[model samples]
Target chain A: MTAWRLIDSGILRAAEHFALNRALLEARRQGGPSTLRFLRFAPSALLGYHQSAEQELRLDACTELGIDIQRRISGGGAIFMDETQFGWELYLDRADLGTRDMSIIARRICEAAARAVSGFGIDARFRPRNDIEVGGRKISGTGGVFDGDALLYQGTLLVEFDVEKMLRILRVPAEKLSGKAIADARDRVASLAELLGFAPPLDEVKARLEQAFGAEFGVTFQPGTPSEGELELYRAALPEIDSPAWINLVGKPRSDLPILEAAKKFPGGLLRAALAFDRPGERIRQAWFTGDMFVNPRRTIADLEAALKNAAGADVAGIVRDFFSTRDCDMLTLTPDDFIMVVHQAMAQAGPERTRP
Target chain B: MTSIGDCLFPDELFYNVDTGIWARREADGTITVGMTSCACSMVGELVAYLPKKVGEHVERNKSLATVESGKWVGPVKAPVGGEIIAVNGAVAAKAAIINADPYGRGWVAKMKPANWDGEAAGLITGAGVRAAFEAKMKADGLSRC
Candidate 1:
């Protein structure tokens, strides 16, 4: 059996880390070995490949906090990455997964990653599309990129989290950065320290992941470093990845994505919906929920938000209906229609205005 | 028109069988490019399309545009490289239009080919289209579009 390779690229600047992302994925695309790599970034705000910096991040805040701003080779939402968290990625051929369906591939990889997180004695599970959550609160978020037959799937593990710090860096659609919002953010996201009562050692964390992935792929990992050829590619890619031009590849005006808000008090609690509406596309680019909601499992709101990102306006009701029907969740007395109605109220500016309930 | 399962391939348009994109040689000389129905099904629904600026020249098989769906983002390569002349504003406004109508209003970009007479040979069309896509679907482990 051919052995898989493993490499550790400890904390580096955002640009350097991304350059390695480019170099290694390129190597894998050109017939390099299937490998797993561990990485971390010194405080940075990274944008997904298709995102516009102006639309996703608060530039003034990122600049003031000495946070490096760059874009991922992969696509997803903008994220705040810092040394406090850890990252893991896998490079493999499609044959390894035995499927080419994008959503299925994502789900399978997340399931394995969830197993890795589960090894830490917390009940972590895969949430469809691309997230690993612990009881509805997200612990890891992932995305993928493919070049030829080689694909790279990567995700972040929140070892230590500061909701306020994240709120400062991101123009989150869910709610404005406020003391109450921070509390809600905590409800939706948590750190390894918060979940386990202490941060697990970095080596133990890596070993747990290695064991999970090794079992999933039915192969053992032999420690290795970037080949010289990969280093050369990394050097060449650094200049472009570190420049201003790369960051502006998908520039869009913030006005194009405006947050539309709606709130309602149900028997369960007051649930607020803040949708970052895409004006021209008539899509909800993202929806954030914040209010005195009393869902048994707090992660329901986060999962619902994930379900509705870039969702079509007309499909909101059906999507919510489908979501509730398929998922096992107890939102006190709140129903899916309550969620749909609030979203419709938020979309009033683009469509027929609904009277406040 | 020829179809493999639910994917439709018009006898008139040419395809880059490797990349799953189609190119149409417009009467006016510019080429219209878009994803095939099978390609659309593979990615589910498109949420965004960012095309290269009009007038920007691209090499053969290079990215003419970036498309995102299901949070998985990647490129739609040019079948025959040339300068982008126009892009579909409607599809940009609502990307699901591409899912709704892949061959018509969803045409991704219009390009002025650099050497259509030469590069056109690289694309498959006519009777060959069906076999090419059939092989592709099998290789991709896809049951249907």
Candidate 2:
């Protein structure tokens, strides 16, 4: 089998990383080599291509902390990256994947990635949509961008994460930024350092990932650098990706997605649901639950939240009922309908008359 | 509603099989463009859509819009490019419309065709859609829609 080139681009700024994203994608589309690249970023807050900075991040906080803000070519939620985070990406033609379906492409890459992470002696699995998880807690999050037949899928692995620092810069309500809430975030996110008791050598980590991906796609990897053509494309796309106009291209006010909460006393415990509602779309943009509920396998809440993300408001009851019907888990004395009740009560607050001034 | 399995290929619309888009020449002489049902099934339910601004001139095979599904972003290539006169605000707000109604109410953009007679002739339509879509599905490795 012919060896594929593997390039490890050292730590750089956010603007430089995204510029490379554009350059590499366009170059590959123009018939350049399909390669695997590893990259790291200095402190930065990157937004999904169609996301608004105002709705996703604290702009003043980002500036005060000196985190470079930029937009990714991919679609997903916003993220905060620093040197502690490692990023890996695959640039390949759609034909090489044996399918033109984007969802299948993302799944195949993520499953291969999960295999790589499992090499660390953790039980890592690819969660639906785009998350690589261990025991239900996310260790890696993924997204992608494509041009013509060429596509780039990328994922981030947490070497050592600072949950508090992340929550500080994220646009959660200030009151919700309590020490306990930050501690709660740790249950939903995992890091290699915490899981393995030490940060593995960077060389070994990269090599293992390359090996796993190679095994999955039946290709060997060889070290190489970017061609001159790709560099020229990078230079051209840089000014655009790093500009404010690009970062703010999809601007929306914070009010567009408002957080609403409802609390109820169930037979088992007091359950509470706070969700971000998209009034126009009539969907729950995201939902978070916190309470003294006795749900074994703590990852259940996060997984439920993931399933409920972007769910229609009217369909919340059926979704909740349907979600629990399939999963083999214990919710103590609390039925899935208990979750439905709280979620509906909260969405009721988003009614037109209630929001109108 | 003519279909190849669950995917629709309305006889009245012209299709660019390679691009997976449809072009409808409206009575006012403007061309309405949208993704074919095959394109919709491939992407799944879209989460976001960003179309070219109204009044922007685009070239053939260039991007008229981009859609995101499950965090994957890709373009909807223009079949016969011209100035984008209007975009569907409904689809912009709710992208599921494309999957639910790919032919109507989910049209991406409306543009005055640059060369209707010339380009429209190249597109497969009418009685030829079934065979064209059958070969396309076979190449795509899709047994069902």
Candidate 3:
């Protein structure tokens, strides 16, 4: 019922922006502010708090590209961020909302964001876990964190185009993205430049996001700045964030997560993939497929990977089924089951090696 | 079996309904513990899991493990007092398994109960498990699983 504070820090360096993340979250948890913030990263490769830079990114490429590689306080996969993207975040109190369920909270906020993105004349929708997409191509990806009663949810919006740069920075499924494979990426990601033929102004984008979030929560935004306490915390957290240990905090063995590759000559064409799996979790941490598979509405594979993120080992079959059952895609003579089989075969090689019973 | 907000609760499992976790006593006198599906669903997809070392004593309702899901990380409290006999190292590496088969291989830890008879009496089982969870779900405004 009350108005929420709005803070827009336009194009800050990675450390400054992440420090604000720490500052604002702490402030909100201690009952400092209930606000919405729009932020931008000045060419940075941000990794999740628990992710290892050595395992997740190609440091050489990042260094050559002059990208600032830092870790986010939140959880999830690493992302390549820069001025070409817009970041939006929200800080709220738990008691101010009715539900205590985390997934419900995520869905509600993500739906609101999707509505905001849709305002730009694209059919943007929230696709579970955390992502905003246009016709199955991811336009935005989000993640968050909470401390005591305070919560922060942040997202990245692709306003312009840059497929090669992202491929260079992230280890990606490198072998798959070479040559024509790079062209395949064009179908998986969409930018305002590609969709609208030009990048929209930052202010206009922020206004649409603010309007959508405000309408969803039935609150107005009053322009504001960080509190003094937040400034203090920002100063304190800066040193830790800039350290090498902070960037490579969760260094685990790459062998723990081996990249398994598999391919099949199907009736449609050749379909192949390189999968990075959490053998113990039986979950596919990341997946990239390239080759010749004619699926209409080209973003099908990206959507499938997004849907399968954090999926249970025993649930992969079901996830694949649900993903295909919900929508119609012209896989020609190839079925979704074919996709699952290929992935499972590759996964089998990485772990203790499961034999068919 | 118990039914809460349309979710199934096997009455055979010993449950600390207040904490949203379950325990099962083994013939050797140790107990196995895990988070309920309702708890997992509430948290969303887990990205990371960290469990206490085996042989460590854990107080009832105190955190025995920590988990991160959808970027929010927090602790999973122990349902009953005991010394952890073993941790599920497999699931620790792949936290999402805790969601897929929460009641099966997803079990978080095994504990040698400090006061099994005393604590066990207070836990809900079978029919009572369903009722207690039903009440919790209703209070939490949750529908069926």
Candidate 4:
């Protein structure tokens, strides 16, 4: 059986963690051995490599709360992380995963991670794109970055997530912070403490992940430390990754991303939708549904939001239609078209009025 | 235009199959670079694009531009060593253009090649484009675009 090195970094500042990300991925690209790393971070708000921190984060709130702002080497949306959550990362050649397709690689890793999370006696499954969830509530979010032939895939497990703090840190629509919105947020994000009534020991969680990954890759994980070469590379990378230039690498006007909202009264109840529209991309970056609308499964809105993320303007109808058709959502006196109309109205509020049927 | 399945490979362009990018030699000494249709299909609709600044020298196989789609970020590598002369403003303002029309208005960058004659010999074109990309797709386990 192939043997892989395992490194457990107790807790590091955001800059140090990002520096390690660059160092480890670069080392693996230069033919280093495959490694599995466990890491924790001090309170930090991380932006995806391509994100503009100003557009995605509440800088004032983050500053008041003493959260370090950093950008990840990987691609994904902004996230608020702290000691309450832990991270797992894998550095391996593309050949090690046996696939060059990003989606397949994501699935393989997420499924294995899901199995690890399920070991806690709660059902967890790999959601599409890159998330692991329990009963439609996200428990872990993942993303990755690749260089040459090597890649670094990482995910965070929320042991005791703070939904309120996260909502405050992220620049979500302000209305999303109300009691009802917070309750809705709680319904969509699951935590180990909430799921199992208590958080498991950190070592136990790490062991579960190690075992699951070993079984998936048919390899034995031998506990190890960062090689001297990797440490040297980390030292070299620190100056760049730790700099402000790296944090503000991608800057865009706030006008490009506008949060627009619309609401309408339906026979069943009032339906409301708030959309974060990317005007330049002409796509929906995110969507949130709230109101008195009655749906049997509470997660239907979250699922719909996931489906609509990054959706092109022209494809919204087809995507929403397909989403509703595939699932059994019981909406009393509320048709899927109603949901589509509200979203369209919200998006229309962004710029010059353009109507879609 | 030459095609393998639904992916278009213009017969006039030189391609680096490994990087899924194409280079078109213009009337001037400059070359225009862009991702092929297959590359766009592989990465869904692009949400963000960041190209190397003009006048910056880039080595062959190094990134000319970085693009993000579906939360996946990756580079569009240069097929030959060159100094970037210009980047597409249209793509910068609306990255989805890269997915909608990768060959025309969606071209990523224009570069003045430092060694076109030498590097051009390594790139595939004309009758060889289809087969080279087919082999790459097979090796990558990718289906027809």
Candidate 5:
């Protein structure tokens, strides 16, 4: 059986948490330990690795709410992390998994974690490139980083989520989420407390994850503290992570990206969407929609977003068409093309160049 | 030249195949580096790229740049320690260019090697780049391009 170390570090400042991420991954790459760590964030807003703080977040809201804004080593959209969510990170050599394919590896680990999450009496499954969901609502989101043979994959388990807080902390324009927008977000994400009517004990959730990983990888973990080397790196990386420049890396004006929203009355219902486009790349950076539409297998919209993530603007129609073409979802009277038409209507502000035939 | 799984791995450039990165020697004795085609296919369309600044010295096998796809961000390690001379400004402005042409306009950086002779000893070149990649793919249970 493989030996893995388990670390449970209580609530930590955003900088310290991220610093440990860098430190532990480095140590493991240098042959430190095959480990799993559990961490908690001190109410914070974390931006993806490549994203600039000014561009992706609402600094005023975050400051007013007392949410610490930071950056993560993994790539993905910005997220609001707090003690309500539990973070689990895995550090291991690539050889340990027997596959060098990044996507395949992500799927494998996510499936294992989903299995463990399901053990908590809620049905959960791996939703793709990186998310775990229950009934189409995301319960967990994951991402990773690799250096040489070592890899660090991490996920957040939403034990007790706060959708309103998340909406405030994220850069979603205030006017957009005034009333119905808040309800729309509630439809997208779910937490354990919401599912089971009470937050499961944090320790029990950790145990389930540990047991699931143990069975999947055929390993046993002895709960322990990080080694001296990891602590050393944590100490060294803290200053770099805590500074404003590090958080504000790659400052680009938001004017480069304008928020455009559109809607239309269709046979099925009203469909609305807010589009974020990268003019130069002509790709959709992010899209969120809220409307009265009937679709079965409710996860279809989120899955659509997953499929359309980073889609080339030039290929929006093709991407939307292909997405619906590949999936079997019942949207009642609305066709997948209708969803496309509504999103395009929102993108009209970008100009006719994006409205390709 | 060898094409595996439709990925072109020219045997002419020196490759650190495991990392899926390649380095080519320029006429001025500097080195040009870029990600392998396999890397592009695996990561999908790269939407964002941030390379280390020009003039900085990076160690062999360390990050020369970082790229993002599907919100997954990771680094492209340097194949040899050297002074970074220039970065691809075009790719910086439009990252899909790297996925479109990894070896040519997509090249990440130009470097003045600090130990070209010593580091070059470890990197494969000529037909060796293609063969090494072929062997790697075979061992990884991959199909030919």
Candidate 6:
């Protein structure tokens, strides 16, 4: 069996972490050893590779909280993370995964990660696209980047997450800050502490992940550190990655991305939705629910919002209906159609057509 | 046009099958580039596109543009070293057009090759285009367009 090097890069600032991302990916492309690295970050808000910090994060809130803001090399939505979450990343050649198709590569890595998380006695499963969830609540989110023949796949394990803090740190619709909204947010995301009644030891978490990946790829891991070559590359890369030019590489106007909203009184209760619609993309970037709707397992609303994120304008109704049909919910005096209607109403507020003219 | 499965590879265009991008030498001595139909099929509906700015110099095998779909982002590499002269504004505004009409309005960028004679040999065309793409699809484990 092949032996892969393992590196534990304890706690680092977000800039250093991102700089390492560039260095390690370059190293892999130049035929460096395959590696499994465990990492943790101080308080930070990370933007996707092609995201604008001004558009995705609340700068004042992040500054007041003393959270460092950085951009990831991988592509995905922005996320607020702190020491409470542990990060796992793999650096390997494309051939090592035996696939070049991005979706298939994501599935194989996520399935192994899901197995590792489930080893903690929680029923975790790999959700399509890129997420690991327990009982419909997401516990981990993943993304990746590639350079020529080299690839870097990374994910975060929520050891003890603060859903309310994340909602506040991001530039979500203002209504999402309410007490009830926090409760709804809590329902959609799961943490190790919330699920197991206590946080699992970091060592235990890493061991399970190491074993799972080893078995999945038929390789044993040997403890190691960054190679001399990688260290040289890291020195060369830090100057560029540790600068604002890299962080603001893809800045876009916030006005182009607006939080559109709509509300209506139904027989069940008052129903309302706030949608972060990306006009140029003609997609609902995210959806949030508010108001006095009494539904069993309130988490259903959050789950519905998760399902609606990035949904094309024409497909919202179908996706919403599909979501309700697959899950059991007790909504008093309110039908699934009502939720779909309110969401459409919110989207309509954006304009007559969601598509570009 | 040459057909490989459901994908179409116009016999006249030059292709870098490994990169899954095609180039057409325009009458004005410039080259128009776009993702092949096979590439569009492999990546589902595109949600975002970020092309390199016009007037920028891009080396061969370097990213000319970045596109995202289903939360996965990948680059469309340049087939030859060149200076980007223009980008497809229509496709930039609505990336789904790249999937709907890849070879037409969805052309990605136009460039003036720095050394066309030096790089032309690297791209495949004519009778060999179909076979090259078929082998690439098989190696990628792609079933059909």
Candidate closest to the true structure, highest lDDT: 4
Q: List the residue pairs that clash in candidate 4.
A: none
The true-versus-predicted C-alpha distance at residue B11 of model 4, in Å, is 2.0
The model with the greatest TM-score is 2
- Residue A351, candidate 3: C-alpha displacement in angstroms: 4.9
Report lDDT (CA) for all predictions: 0.86, 0.85, 0.80, 0.88, 0.83, 0.86
Candidate 1, chain A: TM-score against the reference: 0.94
Cα deviation at A73, candidate 2, in Å, is 0.7
Q: Flag the better candidate by TM-score, 3 or 4.
A: 4
Best by DockQ: 2
Q: Candidate 4's residue-wise lDDT over A104-159, tens digit each?
A: 78889999999999999999999877889898888999988877658899999999
Of the two candidates 3 and 6, the one with more favorable TM-score, higher being better, is 6
Per-residue alpha-carbon lDDT of candidate 5 for residues A174-272, written as tens digits (9 for 90 to 100): 335565767777777899999999999988999999999999899999989988888999999999999987888777777555677788889998888
RMSD of every candidate to native, in Å, equals 2.8, 2.0, 4.6, 2.3, 2.5, 2.3
Q: Docking category for candidate 5?
A: medium
TM-scores of all models? 0.95, 0.96, 0.81, 0.95, 0.94, 0.93
List, residue by residue over A1-357, the lDDT tens digit for candidate 1. Answer: 569999999999888988988899889978888999999999999999888899999999999999899998887888999988999999998878877678888888899889999998999999877888897788998998776567889999999987898999988874467788888778778788899999999898899899999988899999999999999999999999999999888888887778889899989889889988887777887788878877756667888888898788888999999988988888889999999999998898654322211
TM-score of predicted structure 5, chain A: 0.94
User: Which residue runs of candidate 5 sit more than 4 Å off their true CA positions?
Assistant: A173-175, A352-357, B135-145
Residue range with the least summed lDDT across 10 consecutive positions in model 6 chain A: A348-357
Q: Which residue pairs come into collision in candidate 2? A: none
Report the C-alpha displacement of residue A273, candidate 5, in angstroms: 1.6
Instruction: Mark the 10 consecutive residues where model 1 chain B has the least summed lDDT.
Output: B136-145
Which portions of model 2 show Cα errors greater than 4 Å? A172-175, A353-357, B141-145
TM-score of chain A of 6: 0.92
TM-scores of chain A in all candidate models: 0.94, 0.96, 0.94, 0.96, 0.94, 0.92
Global CA lDDT of candidate 5, please? 0.83
Ranking of models by DockQ = 2, 1, 6, 5, 4, 3
